[model samples]
Target: MKFAIFGVGGTGGVIGGYLANAGNDVTFLARGAHLKAMQEKGLTIHTNHRGDIHIEPCKAVSADDYHETPDVLFICVKYYSLEAAIELTRRIAGPDTLVIPILNVFGTGAVMQEKLPDKTVLDGCIYVFAKRSGPGVIEQPQEILRVFYGFRPGQDSRLAEKAAELEKIMRAADIHAHFTDDIQRDALTKFSFVSPMGAACLYFGVTSEAFQENKEVRETFIGLVKEVEALGHAMGVTFDRDLVATDLRLMDAFAPGLTTSMQRDVAAGGPSEFSGLVSRIVTLGKKYHVPTPLYKKIDDWCKAHGLA
Candidate 1:
C-alpha cells in the first residue's frame, strides 16, 4: 500500500519506519532537523522489547515540496498541528485516500472530517510508550505498541477495504493492529487512561508511580476518569467495562518513571495535548452538566500558568 505519514515524530516515525523497512511504499512528511536527518540518513527506531531498527533510503519531503497523493495517510501530529497537517493532507489526499489520525485527543476523526469533508477519515488510537529521542530517531519502551481503528457505525465507506489491507501490511511488519467494531467507544476508552493520567500527573507535579503512592492523587485520577466517562455517556457513547478500575490497574503496572507526553511537553514549555485532553474534559463537563472538579482544578492551573 502507498502510505503517507504526515508528522514523523515518535508514533509516526516508528510505524512508518516499520512499513518502509518491510519494503512497502511509505513517504514521510516532516520538517526542520527531523526532515533533514531522514532525507540525509533515514528514520531510526529504538526499542527495548524489539531490537533497534534503521530504515535508510526512505522517502521524505516537506509540505511545500510534496504533491503526490497516497493510498493511505496517517496524521500523527499533535492537536495544535492539526490545522497545518490538514492543509498538507489536502495537497495529497484525493478521493481514494484513507486518512487515519492517530492522536491522543478524542473526537479527532470527527474534527478532521469536518475540516476535510471529501476524504475518508476514521477513528484510531495507539497504545505505546514512545517518544522522538532526536530529529531522526524514535524510541519505544515496554515493547507494547498496538493500533485500534475502525469506521463509525452506519457509515458505509469504501475505505473499510483499505483498512483491512492496511492491517495486513502492519501485522506483516510485526505491529499489532486491530479494527474495532465501535471506534468512538474505543477512542473514549483509550482516552480514559492517558488523559486522566496526564491531568493527574501534571496537576500534582508527579509521575505515574507517584500517583499510585499517594491516596489523594489516586482518587483524583479516578475522579478524572469518572468525569470523562460521564461526558462520554452524555454524548451517547457506551463504555462496556470498568475503565477507571482498568486504568488504575494499568497505573499499578506502569514503569517507574512512566509519564504522559502531555506532562513532558508541559515541562519542556512546548505546546501539549492539554487543550484536547484536560481542557476538553472540562469543556465537555460544563456542556453536559457533569461535575468535573478534578479536571477543573487542573484546567484552572493550566490557565493560570499559560500551559494551555
Candidate 2:
C-alpha cells in the first residue's frame, strides 16, 4: 500500500520506518528540523531488540508539500494538532483512502470522521514506547509495538477489505497489528491504561517507576482505570477483561523511568494532551453519569497548577 504518516514524530516515525524498511512505499509528513534532517539524511529508528532501521532517500515533506493521495494515512499527531491533521486529510485524502488515527486520545478517529464525513476514518490505538530523540531520529526503548484499528460499531463497512489488507501489510512489517471487530472496546481498553498512567504521572510529577513502587500513586492509577472502564460500560462497551488487572500488568511491564508524552510535553512547558487524556475523562464521567473522583481530583490539580 502507498502509505502516508501524517505526523512523523515518534509513533509515526516508527510505523513509517518499519514499513519503508520493508520496501513499502511510504511518505512522511513532518516539519522544521525533523523534516530537514529526513530530507537530507533520511529517517532512522533505533530499537533495542531489532537494532536500527534506516530509510534513506525517504519521502519526507510538510503537509503543504505532500500532494499525492495515499491508500492509508496514519494520523499520529498529538490530539491538540487534530485540526491541522483533519485539514491535511481534507486536502489529500482520495475516495479510497483509509484514515486511521493512532493517537493517545480516545475516540479520535470518530471525531475526525465527523469533520470529514465523506472519508473513511477508523478508530485506532498503538502500544509502543517510542520517542523522537533528535531530528529525523526515533528511539524505541522497548520492542513492544502493537496497533489496533477498525470501523466503529454501526458505522459503514465499505472499506473493511482494505482495512484487513492494511493489517496484513503492517504485520508483514513486523507490527502487531489487529483489524479489530470491536474498536470501541479495544480502544477503550488501550485508553484504560494510558489515561490513568498519564493522569497519575502528571499529577504526582513522577514516572513509571513511581507507579511501580508508590502505593498511593499506584492506587490512583487503578482508580482512574476503573473510572474509564465504568464510563466505557456506560457507553455500551462490553469489555472482555478486567481492566484494572490488565492495566496493572501493562504498568508493571513498562520500563523504569518511562513517562508518557503528556508528561514530557508538560515538563517541557509546551502543549500537552492534558485536555484529552485527563480532562476528557472528567467530561465523559459527567456525560455518562460515571463517578471519576480520581480523575476529577487530578483534573482539579491540573487546573490549579496551570497545567490544564
Which candidate's lDDT is highest?
Answer: 2
Candidate 2 lDDT (Cα, 0 to 1): 0.92
TM-score of every candidate: 0.95, 0.99
Off by over 4 Å in 2: none
- Provide the lDDT at 305 for model 2: 87
In model 1, what is the error at residue 14, expressed in angstroms? 1.6
| Prediction 1 global C-alpha lDDT | 0.86
* Model 1 TM-score on a 0 to 1 scale: 0.95
Name the top TM-score candidate. 2
Q: Tens-digit lDDT track for model 1 on 1-308?
A: 78989889778987898889889999998999999999998888988877888989879998788888889889999999889878887778999888899999998988888888788888899887788989889988767778888898776678787789889999999889888889999889999988988888888888768877899999888888888888899989988899988888878876777777888898898888889989988888888888888888889987897877
Query: How does residue 165 of candidate 1 score in lDDT?
Result: 85
